[model samples]
Target chain A: MSIIIDEKTKLAVSGLTGREGSFHGLRNKAYGTDLVAGVTPGKGGQDVEGTPVFDTIKEAVDEAGANTSMIFVPARFAAPAINEAIDSGVETVIAITEGIPVLDMLATYWKAKEAGVRLIGPNCPGVLSPGKANVGIIPDSFFDPGPIGVVSKSGTLTYQIGNELKQAGTGNSSIVGIGGDPIVGSDFIDILKLYEADPDTELIVMVGEIGGDAEERAAEFIAAEITKPVVAYIAGFTAPPGKQMGHAGAIISGSSGTAQAKKDALEAKGVRVGESPTETAAIAVETLRG
Target chain B: MDLLEYQGKQLFAKHGIAVPSGEVADNVDDAIAAAERIGYPCAIKAQVLIGGRGKAGGVKIAKDVDEARQYASDIIGMDITGPHGEGPFRVDSVWIEGGSDIAEEYYASIILDRGEKKLLAMVSAQGGMDIEAVASANPADLTKVHIDPTKPFDAAAARSIVESAGLAEDALDEAADVLAKLAEVAREEDATLIEVNPLIVTADRNVVALDAKVTIDGNSLFRHEDLAEIADTVDDPQEQMAKEKGLTYVKLDGNVGILANGAGLCMSTLDVVAQAGGAPANFLDAGGGSKAEAIVNALEVIKSDSKVTAILFNIFGGITRCDEIAKGIVTASGQIDLDLPLVVRLDGTNFEEGLAILAEANLPNLHQEKTMLDAARRVVELAGGAS
Candidate 1:
């Protein structure tokens, strides 16, 4: 009953011959995801521990029936890899690579949208549907199938919340890391919509940070559409204005993208917003119990 | 990644976009010489990244050599605080340009619109005024067009945008040409923002960019080697050190030094520290899969800040294993004479082993917490309480 990915999710690994690609791709395969294909141009026919490698996403889709792609190519080539995934008719593309130029994402995103393909990240930890399947680098040890659905911009923060919830004797339906870039393929509202329609996901945990009006906009959408109880956490409350705090999208530009502003927006929409990751998990736990 | 006005103009000129004729001068004498060469009644503008230089008295019109010398001297050393209260940034250089005969003023820019997932072209006939204000006051005056980056924004497309924004008919053709060039600059130069605030029309009906506000995408800077050189160097010593060490660090006004593995966790660590009655001295993301060396480097950078009395390491292991982070902490304790109180919180992958490693090392100054909240509380208390 998990959203986005499940036991039937056939996966392809882009840049599979590379270091990160092989590491996580093999790991995901070990975790029982249907690892059907590998994509690394010029490395065709080369297999990573028995997984078939192809030169292009099209071959992977055609020969191996790969519906989803996990991209670990370098930033310079990540965008093209994403576009190739879309063009190949893969239903979903998850890019684990960081630092792809914004302009590249703009074009790839437009293409993905037009083609009706779901693209996950450029600088994210990827998604995991516990016990059934794991994609990207989200630790396999963190969860068991349960009622809560998690979506976040921050990878580590998502892990922290998942750990906290697990400690409270709860588990997750799915954990989606939408990435921490200014222009990501998927955003908070996009995942929230999925969670709302999922039968297994009773409550949602959203983790957001400063910069951009995404969270504020998500709050508006949640108020209108999401009937599921949502517990949220926003980072960078103490951040100074005009300073970029680690993530490209995490910055307080003037007074617009402050954590306080985001918190207020979410709270006004009846979403329980936590001051910290631990508190966020507690709120989600309490909501589920209710 | 924000370029100064002169640098932006240089980029614009390189992309075939029209900008006022100018020379950059670092001192008064060169400014006067450059002004004389350009002709009298030129503008001496401060070359600072922050906006509102004109309001800050960082810009002046010089009629002759004496005026040029006076204006240049006044602006070169002037400190301009931005309209947004960004900075009192010191002006190190001045861009002296031949004054334009402004028959009409319009606004044009090409920027990445995150919500739209497209390049947004905003044009307005009401230029020389704040675009935000224009959008709010007279929304129709601000013509907003979302251009797909996959498709070309040629002269024809640009002309339609200019005409729709209600630019003067005579200036439309020339403005469209400049807009098209600006669009090329946005695409080719990998500029996240290319703003010509007052795209001016001269008496001769020539379209010229009076100002350029260009922000090149920092991630794409690797491809743009020449443009990368124009990036503002980190002024903070600790920040510069972190940059060299390949650690993501930002200096903040606080005393409790913070370190975490991910950007979100790092920011949350800061917020938790503040909530726990502590002010975080800085934000440092050790990044995923951090090794012992990165731990030592981050510790050294934090200790270098005399304001830091306590440091917290919040690691929620995903790809970043806790044992590796634990080894890093133990190694950092031995390498640096860390007199400040250190609090470490390890969770997720291999956390028990990581905790066992930290406990075995038994560093006297180090304290281990079971959770991020508890860690923040302990660090704040050890750092002498509420900031």
Candidate 2:
């Protein structure tokens, strides 16, 4: 079966009255996600493009039977919004807001873990299951809904790889942008575990940049648990240590979290690591063909 | 953001952590005045953010006004070469404080350990030396405790930490209190790291934080307005331009300017360019949702760098439309005299339309490559050939 966001997932959009919420809500609806309800603090009676708006996530869940939350709140309110979504008993919560504070995400991440709520991102493009449902901002046009399960930290890089794979006649079962923050809701290991468990995902493609030890930890998990064919690509190989890249988490500190280190870790575990996105796609294709 | 020693001490003092009476001064006259006010036998330390200021002779002790003036003038303008090959900061200011008598030194810090998903509070009796040196030489000298996000780093825990690190019993209580205060300051200020190197124990049995270093969590800066006072905007003109445009840009010491939409792609572009026998002049990420305006701004920033002999634009449009980026590039070239060779690579959404928009420009210095590798090679060859 497909992992995370898929068919039969009822969606609820948070911050529905706001500009970003209204914009992406309609886009997701147009992409054929089960657009059930929306949430705004005070404008409960209002509707954004026929999607019902409620004051809180609890009310939206009660009225619309929504099981998943797509939070598009501003950066300052993102952590609290995720807390509300998790407390409301939603199965999954996907946050699309960027510029969220690292400490704020740390607290919110702890809360999500305690509640056992599966979370996607706080600074991400969200998740997409191709034609079935697009939860985040991933363009549905580049996807055709097939066997490759793609996960990435950067939104545009994910899109770049998606385009390359599509050109190679490869389609994805689900594509997840876990976020590009120092402290994100999910990690490479989390998505790898899910993809390993999913029957429909034949190959796992991981897109990572230099930052924390998430990729190295994922390599350990892939070696120990994941049986799926994995092709990994890490960026920031030439990045100077401590130079802040575009992504908040994309920096090399001292000798740790270098692209070379990550590549070595993954390769030592028998995982194919690619030098570039184009090469990574070919590796995935070759592995699947085998 | 790494706060300087004076700023960190001021923050520590705000939390009631005992710090030596000190004042930050930009000029030697102010520094001498501060030293006179703090009384004779004071310390004059260069207010550079980089480490090894002590080793580089940026730190000195002055017993009189003449010495203070001499030390301040000597340290303020001097460049501080760091131990990690980080920086040779041209000192702009100095922090003058009352010097301590014969005393012992210790180290204490609270850091967010990402791997363990916890807050790591570390302390070492071997303070004057680098903590990395201590951890490698005598791991037992450094005592560390992990605190949960849900729990507070209290005095009792701090006491155990300092005591275990072999702190003398007479100075243990106050040191624990200082540790707790440091932890509180770190938490309240939303700091990723709060460190007090050489947490000094004076001859009077008082526990004082001699030098402080704090890194505020950049992500959470939106909520903490007070910390913004310490945050310095990029001083480099090109980086300052990108910062103003809300684009992530880093200036480098190379010849080829690189631009891309995402951080990963931007970094990959930098790597590929270097691999193809050319050095990137800068790292500029236009971001995912950047439109034509951002593109113009990015181009202007790259063009401002005179070292850039060639420009390469690698746009992998997902949320960013290649066509929109093309319009930005074309419009920017119209705005500025971009008299450098260029290569453009477009993929994903609207590449054909993006190519068509660029095709209309007919810029003689421009070339196109469909693959990232070919584009890197083309730009490098053009840049190297021109050179």
Candidate 3:
């Protein structure tokens, strides 16, 4: 019932022979995710954490019945790996590789869109269907299967906000990290559409930061379509203008990307604006409780 | 990743675009020689990575070799206070260019604007600080066209843009040509920004690029060796070291060192620290899946920063296993004899283990907080932030 990944979704790890790929694959197994198979070009016959490794994504999908893939390839090889996953008919692909060149990502994004595949991130923590399957780098300890659907631009902020939400007794239905890159595979509206349609997701916790017009676009979408009660937190309020705080794409260039502007836009759309992570959770809990 | 004027010209030249003949000089002798070779009436420009150099006396028009030499001696190695005087004002080099008296000034740039997913090429007929003023006062004066990567730079589209921008007949054709060429250069170099501050039309009505500044994406630099070779040597020493370790590091003017797991949390940490009345010295994200070695290296980088009086460890578990971060932090605490205060804010999966590791280490002035606000307050107080 969750947005991107859920209880029934089967997943595989690309580049599973690599260090990060293997570690995450093993952790997925620890959390009881349906880790069907692993894919590494040269090390097909190898196994990482009891998951069988195949040379190609097509072969892995065929043998293990994997529909989704978590790519841990390095930035240089990430675009090709995701392309392989998408071309092989993986319904959803989560790219955990950071530092991917924007050009490569653009091509990959267009291709994924053309192929009708759901692409999550190239520099993000990925998606988590709490207590069921954890896809990206988000900490699982902060999540519980509740009624609130949480989506964030930054991966760690999702966890930070999730911890606060849990402390406030507001469990999460799903948590999606759309990533902080300017050209991420998925946009806020993409996940918002999914969360709005999901029956399990009663309320939404949206965390946006100073960057892009993604928040503005989301505000427009929420104003027109979203019926769910949404509580949002816009990060980097005190940050200077025209400077990137940390994420490569997280720079506040003009009036639109500023935190204050985002909050104002969301508020105009009837979205409860949380000034801090703690406040965001508090408001989300109240909204869900009501 | 802002480029100095000289570096920008180098990028423009690589694209076969016409620019004033110029050379970057480090001293007055080199400046005089370059000016003499280019002839008198040259522009001596201070090569700092910031703007407003002209108003700040970083730019000067030298009518003779003596004036060029004087400007080179004065502007080169001169300190320039940027707008608001927030610094980044070191002057290590100067560009001496054959100057041109402009009949008109225009503005043009190719930047990957986030509001649009594609490369955006913006043009304005007004320039020379007037362009900035125009953008601020009347933004409609700026005509922008988003370049579609699916298609080549359309000359017709560029011509339309020129017409829409209210360029004169000859200037329209010439400006359109320049835009097409710049778009090509931007694609080939994989640049994030290519700004021609003053696209000057001389008295003879020839459109010439008065200055060039290109910011290429650091991740895509593998494609362009020439652009990649312009590695900034004057970057902060701590940032340079962090870059070598494959970590994302940015040095800020604040005093509290912030080390966080994800980019979002890292930014929020800066905000929360600021809200707690503490200014963060730097913004550092150890990525989400940093191992012990990477965290240790990041901590070492933070320790080396002289401005950092305290360290804030804001970890949110999950993919960046708290236990692993804890081990790294504990090891970092012992590896480098830290003299500053440290606050650990750990949450999410395996957080208890991470906390256990920190508690076992028991370093002086090391403490853990249950809430982000509490953690921030504690570290800010230690680092002299108000209650």
TM-score of each model, paired residue for residue: 0.96, 0.96, 0.92
Report the lDDT tens digits of candidate 1 across residue range A75-193.
98888889989999889999999899988888888888889999999899999999889889999687878999999999999988898899899999999999999899999999999
Q: Tens-digit lDDT track for model 3 on B193-226?
A: 8888789888888888997777766677666676
Report residue A177 deviation for candidate 2 (angstroms).
Answer: 1.2
lDDT of each: 0.90, 0.86, 0.82
Better of 1 and 2 by lDDT: 1
| Candidate 3 stretches greater than 4 Å from native | A44-50, A61-64, A241-243, A254-256, B78-88, B130-132, B135-140, B154-157, B385-387
Find the candidate with the highest DockQ and give its number: 1
lDDT per residue for candidate 3 within A12-90, as digits (tens), equals: 8997788877877777767778889899888888887678999999998888999999999988888899999999978
Model 1 CAPRI rating:
high
- Residue A223 in candidate 3, Cα distance off native in Å: 1.7
lDDT of model 3 at position B342? 88
Model 3 TM-score (B-chain only): 0.92
lDDT by residue (tens digit), candidate 2, A131-156 = 78999788778877789999999887
Q: After superposing candidate 1, which stretches have Cα over 4 Å from the reference?
A: B385-387
lDDT of 1 by residue, B1-387 (tens): 788899999998898878888899999889988999999899999998776777889889999888998899888888888777777788989999998899998999998777777888999999987778888988999999988666678998899999999999988888899988988998899998888989999899888999999988889998998887765376678998998899998888789999999999999999989998888999999999988899999999998888898999999888888999999888887788978889998988889999999889899998989888899999999998545
Go through the candidates in order and give the C-alpha RMSD of each one to the true structure: 2.0, 1.9, 2.7
Report the lDDT of model 2 for residue A82: 93
True contacts kept of each: 0.87, 0.72, 0.64
